[model samples]
Target: MKEKFALGTALLVASTVPVFGQQYRAGSSDTMDQNNQQDTQRGSCCTSCCDECCPPKDPCAKCAQLWPSCGPDWIITPGAGPCTADGCDFFVTAEFLYWAVRQDHLGFAVTLPEPETTSVGEISHPDWRMELGFKVGIGWLTCIDGWDLYLNYTWLRPRTKNETASSKEGFFLQDYFLFGFFGPPGDFTLDNETAKWKLDFNVLDLEWGRNFYISKCLHLRPHFGLKGTWQEQKYDITANATQPRGSTQFFDTITGSADLKNDYWGIGPRAGLDTAWHFSRCFSVVGEFAITALWGRFDSRAKATQTLFDGSVTPAEETTTTIGTGSFKTEFHSVKPVMEFFLGFRWEDWWCCDEYYTGFDIGWEVQWWGGQNQFAFLPTETRWGDLGFHGLTVRARFQF
Candidate 1:
């Protein structure tokens, strides 16, 4: 009987061994209870050993996590402000865009190439120009709930095409020297040619955007808004051969300085959408495509000229120089389309408190814009050359 009782007790102890080894069941509640009990016992029995034995872990770290600002080594509010798990309430950013641009003049129609000829005049003269440019901008941001809105102002300028000057004789002189038919500047005359002009513009825009978080460290930014853009273009058209003899629209008739300008302004509205992908807490990549439609005018005005000369009486028969101005109300419109890919790094810290935040972004961009100009023959002949422009831009932002 004693042996049989000892055997039964051993069997009961053996059964309880499995339960002790498991520590918890297969359910989440059981697991949580077990973890809590272990944590408590470890804290009570081995305070120093507990920290060394179990390291801290982020319970929620995954792609598409909600609350992107909750990550390791991230500073929420560095300055004097109320601390929050999210981020600073106010922020600013400074960004710059640097790009390599390939562009040309939107000139008149090109006559098909005549059979190969030796004369520069017989060879077609199409205005095909090339240049490079860059732009800079500053912006501010306001966040409410889970949505973020942005307002930015950008200043862009073409570094290469600040100004351009070309005369028919200049080309002739070049050809003559290359072909070994060297001659003086006035010895040759050119006709029906347009002067090289400086083509550039500046843009100001206000946009509202919204971002949604998918994960603790990752989010998606999809936004659409209206942007206001402006432009300024100044160029010259010459009527004289070597100097300003007939008009002063291209150069000074007396000093031989060919510095004439015709200026115009363009204003319009642009509407489009962009998407951004955030990786980690302070790094992101964005892809944007937008269509811009603009309206403005172009007028014909230029510098004054000197009086004409009587060629019949004097040996140097300088004709009386009279200047005439023509004003044409031009409406310029285009489906200005742009594509840009950018990788940005962000520093999310408000300097003086949760009052504001600041950051900087830069990247590459390509643009293709074409529309109708007042120079068109008809009011509706909205066919301008398929012109292309490319460059880079940098910008800064302050968020509130």
Candidate 2:
């Protein structure tokens, strides 16, 4: 008998389930059914019929009549219940239904595009000479996310310091102009003074290679490329007494400059590694270390023109005249190894995030060469100077 009773209860609950939901009656201006019939009889004309005079037919009445538990428990009379389905179990809720169809459905279909890698290189050297200068590089990336095929150029002008000379005649200044030709005939006249030493270096590199991701946080790049470099240095020096009041002498002078000129074309393989750590969606720290082995010959030239008043001028000679032209050229084979490093922060997808990136780096570079210190017609010890530098870099890029 107990089992039979339980079975009957289950059947009743199941049968009344459909009536437990929201209902609408045709042409009945009422929102819900009221217990009083007086309102229903008084006004079938408008929706404001009072409950006491014109109670409308119950929308849930048919099922409620079969299963009485569904009438007041699950159905609402508009003003008496909350706007949502709350006090039920195993049935869908109003809040759940609205969210499943609206918010959740839209967010899942929108995704950010894949990130693009570029073929540009940007680098810097701090102590380029003496003035605290910098260098910049950029290029283009080819097929594959991190691979690049590039042409790059860099510039640097280091700081200068004053240099002293023993005699004005010893103050040697080149007579080369913009066209690499001799300047006006004139001896470098330094009234036994000191002048600033100037230093400059520049390069252009054409490289092709791929940057491989060793892990999510690390990248390694091994490249083969060609490089061309140009370098210039200047300095002054003083020599101890040894003269006929005025004598032509050859003594080493430190102009504060290392080498006067150098130019070379090199071909070799380059390798590098970069590391990155992403802490969040919008911030990351990155660093890189690169090396290039370049072998090439540098053809260089230096000239100093001296203008001496014409001593054999006629008695009371007219306007004065100058004479004599001197110059020298040199060529040598050299191999240079270059090293570079950087540390910076990367901002993600700033302009639509995945379309481009910006970075600021502080780093340094060192170049070591294997070659002769001097050559024919070239100063015996003018081929090397400070080969290390450090600086900062700021860059912007677009990914394809």
How many residue pairs clash in model 2? 32
lDDT assessment of candidate 2: 0.38
Model 1 — TM-score against the truth?
0.51
Tens digits of per-residue lDDT, candidate 1, 223-274, equal 5555555554443333222344354343322211122332344455555555
Clashes of 1: 43
lDDT of 1: 0.40
- TM-score, every prediction: 0.51, 0.44
When summed lDDT is taken over every stretch of 10 residues in candidate 1, the lowest stretch is: 173-182
Stretches off by above 4 angstroms in model 1 are: 1-88, 99-143, 159-188, 191-194, 215-218, 242-280, 293-358, 372-383, 386-388, 396-400
RMSD of each: 12.2, 25.4
| Positional deviation of residue 137's Cα in model 1 after best superposition, in angstroms | 6.4
